[model samples]
Target: MSALLDIRQLHAFYGKSHVLHGVDLHVGAGEIVSLLGRNGVGRSTLVKAAMGQVAARGAVRFKGADILGLKAYQIAHRGLGYVPESRDVFPTLTVEQNLLLGRKRNADTGRWRLGDMYRMFPRLEERRGVAAGLLSGGEQQMLTLCRTLMGDPDLMMIDEPTEGLAPQVVAPVARYLLALRERGIAVLLVEQKLAIALDISQRVYVMGRGAIVFEGTPEQLRQDGGVRREWLEV
Candidate 1:
């Protein structure tokens, strides 16, 4: 079977500084793949390049079509959802309103619904009418994830979904991601938390110096102390 997302020799730059150098990776349908690395190793850049959020060269193929030069919105319309490390929620909009904004044009289509989001995070339902700015950091993160799901993306590229949150809040995020996989939505997760990434992902890739240095099942990564020390351990 072909990959749902395929990237080959991807190179990205900001001004004249190159960030990603010949990075290659793939995500298969119904798979949860994590990109792991310490800071400044270009994990986020790889996802941004895949989403057309940065200037990049080389191939980014989605379901067999070249998507390298497409604009961000165009790429999104092609069923790829991006949840940045920074949780971006419209401050003034009500919780429900924020979710409504994420709905793709033909409302009745897609696998996810507002009710599904609420079911996944009951707090969102409780605060359905509250302004998004009033939500706590954890709540905002959940909102952002649900908002992206509201778009009904076939593949979600999430960057650091558990960056800053109480311990109680972290597990739910993992469960939600697992649920996405169970529902057959492919995920390309970019995460720094080793335990969470390893626990939830079927496969993992470790990045170093803007390139993929290792790829294997989670169990293999757990046993490779050398790679963990060089690329993941702080």
Candidate 2:
């Protein structure tokens, strides 16, 4: 598979404090790659840097072109979508309205459509007229994911997608991500849950002290208890 998003020697800083240190990773077309680490290890920072959400330096190439210095919106317009950990949906806007905001102008048509999002999560369709702020946590998370998809991105970086979701709801989210992969969309998922990451990702990168310590397939990671104990296990 060809690389959809690539990062090499990535470094990011929050004000005076440095967070990410030479993090290198890649997501291939039609693949799901999970970034797993303990809190504060800069997993989220790496994705933020890729999206230009924070001050970052070094190579961030999307679809074989450098996008390191582009603004967040500029990156989005380049077919790189981001769903932040906070699930930044428009609170005042209705469900459909918030999704409409994600539609890119003059973008080359992609597989996802508004009707597809509604069909994927019928609950969203039910509350199409309801304000986003009034939706439940799981519903908001769904909205955020579907909203990003509306932009027809070739690659999506999502942070903590199941952070606050109920157990039953988590399965559907995982399935939906797999569906994205089936549709040839690459996913960079930053998640805290070991089971979900292990279950869904084609490959995994373990971060320790802001750098990747291990990169391998799920089976390889599962067989290495030392890496898990040092970087991932709480």
Candidate 3:
């Protein structure tokens, strides 16, 4: 099967500080892949480069086409959805309004809807009328995922979805990602939480110093103490 997103020898820069030194990665259709790395290793930068938020030099093929020179909005129009580490929800907007922003009914139809999202996260439904800024951190994260789903993206790149959330909240978010996979949506997840990534992803790529150092199944990652100690340990 062809990959939904394929990035080869990707190099990116933030002003003079060059990051993402020749990173190569891919996400196959309907598969959940995890990008695991420690802080400052450019995992987030990889996602940003894919989303075209930063200047990138390399080949980024989405659905078998080059996406290198496209703008961020162009990438989104091509059916890529991004949930940044910060959960980029509109603070002043109501929950319902925020979700509406992602709805592209004229485009492809996926299993994501306001009702479906609410079912996946009942808290969001309960707070539909409330302002997004007033919601708790966990609530905000859930809202972010739901809003992204409204866009009906074929491939979704999620950056650190479980970060700073309570364990109780993290479990449900992980389940939601699995559900997305069941619906045939490809997901590329960037996570610092090793267990969370292992629990949800079928394959894992460990990033060290802006490059992929290890690519294997979840069990392989668990059995390698050297990888765990070097790349994952705090």
| Highest lDDT against the true fold, candidate | 1
Q: Tell me how far the alpha carbon of residue 38 in candidate 2 is from the true structure, in angstroms, after superposition.
A: 0.7
In model 1, state the lDDT of residue 188: 98
The number of residue pairs in model 1 that clash at the backbone is 0
Q: What range of 10 consecutive residues in model 1 has the weakest lDDT sum?
A: 103-112
Error of 2 at 134 (Å): 0.6
Tens digit of per-residue lDDT, candidate 2, span 1-234:
777888999999999999988888999988999999998999889988898888999899999999998899999998998999998889999999999888885435557777899888989999999999999999999999999999989989999999989998898899889989888888999999999899989999999998999999999999999999888877
Q: Which ten residues in a row have the lowest lDDT in candidate 3?
A: 104-113
Clashes of 2: 0
lDDT of each: 0.93, 0.91, 0.91
Q: lDDT of model 3 at residue 19?
A: 91
List residue ranges in candidate 2 displaced over 4 A: 105-108
Candidate 1 per-residue lDDT, tens place, 141-205, comes to 99999999998899999999999889999999999999999999999999988999999998999
- Can you give the TM-score per candidate against the true fold? 0.98, 0.97, 0.97
Which residue ranges in model 1 land beyond 4 Å of their true spot?
A: none
Residue by residue across 1-234, what tens digits does model 3's lDDT show? 798999999999999988989999999999999999888999999999999998989999999889988998888888888999898889999999999988865634555778888999999999999999999999999999989888888999999999999989998998999989998999999988888889888899999998899999999999999998998898
